[model samples]
Target: MLLAPENTRFSFALLWTLATFSGFLLSLLFIEIGEKPDIGVLEATVGGFAIALLQGCLLKQPIFCIRWILSSLLGWSIITAIGIGALGWIVPSTEFLPLRILYGAIYGGLGGLGIGLTQWLAISQPMAVVWRWIFVSSASWAIAIPFGSVVGIILRRLTHLFLGEVMGLAITWLVVGILTGINAHKLRS
Candidate 1:
């Protein structure tokens, strides 16, 4: 019997997908139950940080884990602050749904950029691998928000109000996972 070569890329992607999915689901549940937004944020932060640490473990790089944790936390905080600050200005309180979605996509992309840059600086991977990391992370984040918003809109139309965003997030993370896996493999090679 011949065994297939171990693909760390796929493993990393799968783990990331599961972690993000779980975090989004938990946030949705809290939203449905009328919990505070802070709870959701906290849950998501913890989940993301935990998953990042796991990735470090898989890569046998404790420095990457620590950097990821710090970077993720800082990136999220900065983005969230910017989003709130810009909400009334760029995405007025009375803005239409589509506009809001666009804003989210832009914000997500920027935040992802920060995370990607941090990953590149901290991971000590080859230049190409680091570049790929930046590109994939930024693109995934940028695309996910709008895609999720669309899903949410459709679900709302279908009267599945709560699940729409959740479904959108799932789809986004699925794509991210696939991309991450591919890149991980490439990096290994």
Candidate 2:
């Protein structure tokens, strides 16, 4: 298989970011329909679907697209379910920047592992190259969440915006898309 072009990688990142952001906004509407845990699962499912659908479009092999989407949905939902179940025990409530970043990294890493493992099934690559994806995915989210959360908090406080969380999520997705996009290109190449 030929390597994916640079523009294609960029397109993948851009689409992934937009789709995820939009999915998050749509998921927010379901907040009143269920309990917090249920809602979190719902959000993860929606976000995963949206993200995978768009990201799959950029895949060199069209045959794997559906598998990609399904795997992502399953991965995200399962991970979110686990995370929700362990929320209080695994992560503590804290406003401290360092703690927040640490917790975010931990949470993001686990979530990334879940998603990466599932998504790995759809990737057509050697084990050596593909295994790096799991780490890349984990690191991407590990960095993105904390940076986005901190920025979102600061922006919310400074502007007093009601939907400042959206901004933070946007930043998070952007970072994720960029990091994963580059790695994906390298993997495929």
Candidate 3:
């Protein structure tokens, strides 16, 4: 019976999806309370963690999945994909690509680092810097965005016919990193 599973068993993706749905709801609340919509790069990273909180209701999470890297990757990837896409769609851009793939590198790097941190802490960090809190806000993004932006270089290099040489990946990395770092620092206080 130990190996036999019932339909009651839920997949990790589904659980995460539920958490994501909850975080999305909270994001709307942030906008509503602020009375204005703002799409900062780190918004997704933080919000993704906020989504993770919903897990507390379903399981005794602080549950470790694949040691550390996967957790960091999931956090950063979900954050970047949702955050960047939303920003592009919600905000009007005079000049910018709809989706920035360069963020993958940033996602990979920061995600890697966060994984290291969590592993070093054994995923037992306190709730104030809670996994859930990271989901719905921009804190984690602030920490990871600059690193995420680095993907732009590879993107530009590979797609020479389109983005060309003026994409400014360097600037994007610098700005996103500084801003995300500052914002996360502020939130931590």
TM-score (all chains, Cα) for each model: 0.68, 0.78, 0.33
Model 1 deviation from the true structure expressed as Cα RMSD, one decimal place? 5.1
lDDT tens readout by residue for model 3, 130-184: 4443442343333333333334434555886324222333333334333333322
- What TM-score does model 1 achieve against the real structure? 0.68
Report, for every candidate in turn, its global Cα lDDT versus the true structure. 0.54, 0.65, 0.37
How far residue 89's Cα lies from its native spot in candidate 3, in Å, is: 12
**By lDDT, is 1 or 2 better?**
2
lDDT of 2: 0.65
- lDDT-best of 1 and 3: 1
Q: Which ten residues in a row have the lowest lDDT in candidate 1?
A: 85-94
Q: Which candidate leads the pack in lDDT?
A: 2
Per-residue lDDT tens digits for candidate 1, residues 53-108, read 54454454566567756766555444445442211012122226778477657765
Model 1, global lDDT:
0.54
lDDT of 2 at 78: 84
